[model samples]
Target: MVGAMSLRPRILSSFVGDRFLHSTPPLHQLFRYNPGSKHVTLQLSRTLSGLTNLLFNRRNLDELSNNKRKSLKPGKVSPRRPVPGHILRPPYVKSKQPPGIASGPEVHDEKGVEFMRASGRLAAQVLEYAGTLVKPGITTDEIDQAVHQMIIDNGAYPSPLGYGGFPKSVCTSVNECICHGIPDSRALEDGDIINIDVTVYLNGYHGDTSATFFCGDVDEEARQLVQVTKECLYKAILICAPGVDFKKIGKTIHDHADKYHYGVVRQFVGHGVGRAFHADPVILHFRNNDAGRMMLNQTFTIEPMLTIGSSNPLMWDDDWTVVTEDGSLSAQFEHTILITQDGAEILTQC
Candidate 1:
């Protein structure tokens, strides 16, 4: 079972407006229901309270909508553009593509390995460029626009554009958001931590990578969380080798995170990335007993999401963005790696 964290519900009473109360009935008039019952009941008072609650809830909802609109300014959907004819697109982008095109991990031959390497390099480069654009006051939508252009300029296709109907080219997860954050108009503020995930398709192969970045100066606790999360990823990666048990990766990650009092996200696990954006032997980031073994030429990703509070995540209503259940800060790092003759190669290294 996935871990559950305590959540601190945000009270938005401050956002309530007087307009919601204008139609509400007065307290005396609200008490119209019968109060007498053989079973001894306060039906009238209960009815009055229910009416009052209904109005208050309506007001709260209005305030929430207004606050969301105000906080996210200049947010716009990314425009669809044409890809170069020579560029190879994932099967999902092709009309009437076969379903099995995206499946389990497959071993790559010499030429296929080279294609994977090129795609990995481009993904890493795009992520590095996106990191440079991180700063206070910039909306995530702006970052998405820049990343979209960068991927296209490099003669590649952004893998996430239409995969599973995802709207953006890159994922920009901020603060409490754990992963798959859809870029929006929310302007980043000082001390905010964000993760920029980039995946590009080149020469019929896919490369994926992501890292948590700080916006301006962050607090000591947040900084440590990001640092430890990064360490968890590397520690897991260090154990990758031909014949190594896949379970060891999660064990290492869990052990390191436990020492720091951080929570490891279990809902989402890393996976093979190459011809398909996601495939198998599923890579878990917490303790597990999976029997899969690493093999040479097998390429996969190792990404660990660590949370400052509960590791349990609650999905946003959009069905994509994942946030900590407790609304605490979370950080993640990812890299595509290839098992080699002796050890492993970090294909997505910048």
Candidate 2:
């Protein structure tokens, strides 16, 4: 599963600390949460000169010539769907809150690896079916319904349904949304791009995967952003192995994003996934000096977020949806992987 990286100091807890990974980006703005206040405050940092010029690729020019379109708005979310009694729910489902990331890496035994592979395959199959329903006029809620049914039919649970009170069975991030978008009643429009994040729990293990898809008649600029974002994920995955430093994943993604002048989002990152949805060591998608190493039999995820404009995010009121501050287009891709003896095996593949 993917989550926003925050540096807020907090008392250590099983669930709380894992969600608060630390990182400091050269962001033009910073977000601060005021506990007494209901919402997070968006604080401005020193502006980077020529940033506008730097982000003004073909996408920005096209938006200017055509006049910018409306930013993403929240649609009416349907009531929480119910799972069958026969399906076993994750422990966090009892609390209706996510148990924070697990303490250590998700290192598994040989038999445990097989369980992981089962869940990962189901997640990939579900995600593939979800992508097929991405045509214009189809509401994201419809997609969620189809996905929810398929997972249950396979005797698996939809991992996102109740974790931290997430309302949807799957995350449907459309257009500028960076991550954690809830599926709602809004219909997909022509030329829109979307990211579908799917995770499933089966036989006591969790599998996570996601992909960005296009609606009818998408523009070349958005298409390029989606393609490059996907390439960044694969490029990062290729460098992963038993002894590889975790920082190399960030470097691999950051360097490739730099080549196209795209912005690599720093707030959200990948994590260890297996028995629990999110675990450690925290995987950063941008360049940094985080000192962590991969080990054999370890399983985790590598997801990257890339944007055509400002990488800074503006969180919506629901506290789940994350969108680009400048309303620029963003795209992401993710997969769960296992560190094998020679290299890494992508578990979340069909």
Considering summed lDDT, which 10 consecutive residues are worst modelled in model 2? 9-18
TM-score of each: 0.76, 0.87
lDDT of the candidates, in the order given? 0.71, 0.80
Please write out the lDDT profile of model 1 over residues 73-152, one tens digit for every residue. Answer: 22455565456777777887753222222245657999989998999999999999999999999988889889988988
Highest-scoring model, lDDT: 2
| Candidate 2 stretches greater than 4 Å from native | 1-7, 10-68
Error of 2 at 187 (Å): 0.3
Clashing pairs in 2: 15-100
Q: List the residue pairs that clash in candidate 1.
A: none
